[model samples]
Target: MKVFVLGTGGWGIALAMLLHHNGHAVTSWTFFQEECDLLHRERANEKLLPGVRIPEGITVTTDMSGAAEADLVVMAVPSFAVASTAEQLSRIVPAGTVIVNVGKGLDSQHGYCRFSETIDRAMGGRNPVVALTGPTHAEEVARGVPTAIVAASASRAAAELTQAAFMNDTFFRVYTSSDLVGCELGGAFKNIIALGAGISDGLGLGDNSKAAFMTRGLTEIARLGVTLGAKQETFAGLSGVGDLIVTCCSMHSRNRRAGILIGQGKTAQEAMQEVGATVEGYYATEAGYRLAQQQGVSMPITEAMYEVLYNGLSAKEAIRMLLGRPRRGEHEEVWFH
Candidate 1:
């Protein structure tokens, strides 16, 4: 199988390497001329997946038309850039080609999962889109660590095909799911929970406090997600619980690191600049807060995070505001079936 990864960022480079390592012919396309030149001439992607050597036979190109003939195309760009990237690719990729996305989040202005229905709308004339998501991180993946992810498509056959093509014996695992909404919602909402957990960590709270925060944060996430047509069971899976635990606790989590700085009395701008990466949580937290308000769900963590991030409430004040909320039954069982 010939695969082309649309972005040459960390995830895209990692996936390209994984696909090639699985004995598939792989090529990575980069929009940046320097990255393409570096891969072609220096056999490196120093600007993106730096220090990783590209194996032989993997091509890198800046020509969109050059990669259009691939058997499968994977998108690993950030959510904020997905729409324009999708639009550009839609113009070049042939109809019926397998389109897959790994970005997670809802659009703030529109409030739908990234690539929710908009992907199909943007595809000039393409087949159904597929979503790939899980707890996997790019750095771990670059080192060939074992990881499992779900591939969701309206067409089960498409999902299965992606599973066959992407999954490997030891390093990479892919499962099939018809529940696209669940997969999409799980991928996005877990980041918000990670933000809350990071704040706890910054406040010098121990694992006990962080664990409790994670559980309650998830309750709010599930509430908002279920009200908007996601499955409750999906909350127990990799994109949900598994991803939350890893992101909320790990130093590798840029989102959590950013939040910790905020909690330690740094301004949001200072924290973000210090983190120096795409901390998806800061943006996702706002979208989640808006979504919670729209759904009329009481997301205290989400509200506190929004206040700290957007409304100019100091992080300490936000924490105090949350503690001041009237306590209620901790186990209300908000099942929406």
Candidate 2:
């Protein structure tokens, strides 16, 4: 299979490497001419994944038309860049082209899943939109570590098609699902919990706090996800629990780093600047807050995260606020009650 990946970020380069290693011919496109030049000239993305050279078999281009014509086009662009990138590719996406979304976050400006409804709108509602997400980090994935992900689409056939396109023996595994919305919600909401976990780390809170926050934060995820019509079990799968575990515990999670900074007394804005990369959690917590209210869901952890990210509440204050609130049975709303 011939695969084309859009964007020049770490994720984009990583996917290109992974797919090429899987015996597929891959062409990676970037809007930035400089990055393409770097790939061709140095075989490396010096800015994003320094010291890890891009493999020789992978081709890099700045031409959007060339990428859009492949057997499939993977959108590895950032959340904010997905819509515009999709629109740019819209002029060229072949009918029935499988558009896979690897970006995770809520579209803050328009309040939609990253490339979810937007890609559908961009393609005139013709192409299949698949989401490839899980707890796998790009850096580790690029290094050929064992990683499994859920590929979700409205069409099970499409999901399976993408799964086949991505599977390889060395370190990558793919699972297929037809629950597009649930898979997407699982991917989106886990970042917020990662942020809270980072805060706990920064505050010098013990493992108890981190464990409790992540566990409870997932409840908030399922409650809101169910209210929005997502499958309840989706939140317990790779895109949800799996992603949450790696992100909250790993140093590679920039979202968690951002949260830790905020917990250590830095403002949200400062933490973002210091992280110096796209930390998806800051925007997502805000989106989750609004989505919860709109869906009539009770999400205390999400609300507190919103207060910290948007309302300028300190991490200590947020912790105190949560502790001060009334308590309830753990399985009150969850199943198995």
Give the TM-score of each candidate: 0.93, 0.96
Off by over 4 Å in 2: 333-337
RMSD (Å) per prediction: 2.7, 1.9
Q: What is the per-residue lDDT of model 2 for residues 1-337, given as tens digits with 9 covering 90 to 100?
A: 8898998789888999999988899999888887778779999876677678888888888887786558888999988887888888889877888899998887776665555788988889888999999988888888888999999998787898899989987789999987788888878889999999999999999999999999999888988888777898998999889999999999899989998998899999999999999889887888898898888889999999999898888788899999999878888776564
User: What shift in Å separates residue 225 of candidate 1 from its native position after superposition?
Assistant: 1.0
CA lDDT, candidate 2, residue 200: 97
Enumerate residue pairs that collide in model 2.
135-243
Model 1, 233-308: lDDT tens per residue? 8878887787888889888888899879877878778888998878788888888887788788888888888888
Best by lDDT: 2
Measured on C-alpha atoms, candidate 1 has an lDDT of: 0.81
Candidate number of the best TM-score: 2
